[model samples]
Target: MIMVTGASGALGSLIAAKLAASGREVVAGTRRPTGSARRVDFDAPDSLAEAFGGVDVLVAVSAGFAEDDVVIARHRAVVEAAANAGVRQVVYTSLTGAGEHMSIAPAHRATERLLAAAPFAVTVLRNGLYAELLSQAAEQAVATGVLTLPLGGGKVAAAAREDLAEAAARVAVEADAQVDNAHRGRVYELVGSEALGGEDLASALSAEHGKEIAYAPLSLGDFRAALTAAGLPPFQVAHTVSVFANVNAGFMGGTESDLPGLLAGAPRRAIDVL
Candidate 1:
């Protein structure tokens, strides 16, 4: 049996639905149990063993959008439970290699280390930032006629969330079928084919709305101040600033990706999505 943790989440739900449609014996692991879905709360480590029981392949969606320590602890608990449950293989959705300098990278790297030390075979899907997220900037630009961000000249290799979910499902299904262990112990850099910058977002918005949208660059300090003024928590403010800092330093885009190779067709155009 294949089980997907965080199955009620945006990404995990897509994976579970795809796997089930493929005629596989799939289990949904969520915090709230409904129907046959198992309660797999990362915060409640004791409940994980039973949640993972009898599952040959486990898809561990990266959790915790809080502080670094909190995220690491949640991942550690899931790893330990998966080990004790005798899961044969684990597929983890992690941050992309290009996002190594982002504040969120540490927790994902910590999770990768934990999974490596476990007994089961592992596949790391280093997914890129979602195009859906980047579209938010475009939406804001359409309203104000100005796309403003701390990403100076840097571009993000953003992939569609649906594409990333599909890739994860494919890897888990192969692992469940024991398909030569080809993906086992492998790390796939699932970034997008096209890299988008602030100007790119402005252009997309201009075309979509038939208006002139301009790109306005904001300094990191100014961005942080705005976020703080909006009453964001300390951890969230820090994480958001770090993401902008990394992007501004040209650390969030890459030339190659394993995304298309794993998918059934070409990746969706990020600009079109925006």
Candidate 2:
């Protein structure tokens, strides 16, 4: 049995569906398992014993937005439980280049460190940015003909979240003679084959929307101001803008990874990933 955390989410649902389709028993882990019949509550320790009791592997799909201590503590507790459960394989979905000193890297890095100490075999999928993450901005840009952001013409090797989910399921559900050994311990930088800058993004938006959606570069200060005006906390705006700045410094791209190799021969196109 494979226990998949965050089963109610988009990524988790995809992972569960794929594994079940392969005739694998998926013990989905969620805060509340009411929606998914194969689910288990992650926050309830008593529930874990039964869920992890006979599971062969654990696919820990992280819940993003740990902008508070409570969230961090809860996340850490789950990691500890996985270790104590004595599961054979532990697979985690993480951001690409997490903890490499970028804005959100610290949190991801901290988790990586904790998970690394686990006695069980582990696989970390350091997935890159998601294309859908930019859809709202792209749509707004299309409406205004201005692709406005703090990005200063740097590249990002982003892939779709669903694609990453599929890869995660493939790793967690299949083990022993079925597991892909190349993914273990090694952080696969699951990058999209194409790397594009802010300007390139604007161009793509313009082409897709059939309008002159041009890039509007802004400094971190201005970006924060814009985000604040748009109703986000100052610190969150700062962190978000800071990440975009890191992208400008070429922090989001990687040349080679086993992700592409793993997804090869599938019925999906890399473009469809968006």
Candidate 3:
């Protein structure tokens, strides 16, 4: 039986749906477990028996603020629950740089450590950035006929969310956990075949929409000014500008291992994702 945490989230729901469709005995777990079979909720240490009565595999999906301490605490709790349940396989949907030097890597790294000492065989799916996140910007490009962001031509090997979901599902079902055992102790530099820069992204949008859209490379300060002019809060605009700067500095994207191969196919094209 496969149990998925955060089953209500976009990627988590997709994973559970795919597993159920594939005829796996899936336990749809959420904060509120109802009439659903094999359901689970967040419970205290003494409540293990009720929380994990019949689960065989565990899939951990996290959705919350990216605070490292909070993330680490939740992930540690998840590992403890899995260990107590004596699950056979443990699969985690972690961010791309979870084991590297990115600011977002610490929580996942701590989670990996907690799981490594446990008895269950573990696999970590170090997922790449999502191309679907570009939809809003893409629609704006199609609307205003211009593609602009703070990203200044740095390339990102963005993968679709579906590809990452498929990989997670596959990780849970594979017969030899050892194939991903090295994956447990290590991080996979997941990426798309085509690394896209902000300039190239604008071009892609132009090509798709048949518009005269062009990339607008702005100074970080100017980008913040634009966002501020658009009525965004100072804090949010600050965060947005900072992230784009990071992306431009090549932090959110990396390329090496082909993540699509883990799903046994090529990733969905960026336009298709759009």
Best by lDDT: 1
Looking at model 1, report the run of 10 residues with the lowest lDDT sum. 130-139
**For model 3, the run of ten residues with the poorest summed lDDT:** 175-184
lDDT of 2: 0.70
Decreasing TM-score order of the candidates = 1, 2, 3
**Pairs in steric clash, model 1:** none
Which tens-of-lDDT digit does each residue in 1-274 have in candidate 3? Answer: 8888878878888888878776667887777666784444444434544666667778888744445666776677777777777777777777666225555556667777887888887777777667876778778878887776667867667778887778777767652233344445444456566677777887777787788887777678898888899998665576566556667787655567647667777777766677
TM-score of 1: 0.96
Model 1 lDDT at residue 171: 92
Instruction: Give lDDT per model, in order.
Output: 0.90, 0.70, 0.70
Model 3 alpha-carbon drift over 4 Å, by segment: 33-49, 175-187, 218-243
Backbone collisions counted per model? 0, 1, 0
Instruction: At residue 168, give the lDDT of candidate 2.
Output: 81
Best by TM-score: 1
Q: Which stretches of candidate 1 lie over 4 Å from their true place?
A: none
For model 2, give the 10-residue run with minimal summed lDDT.
265-274
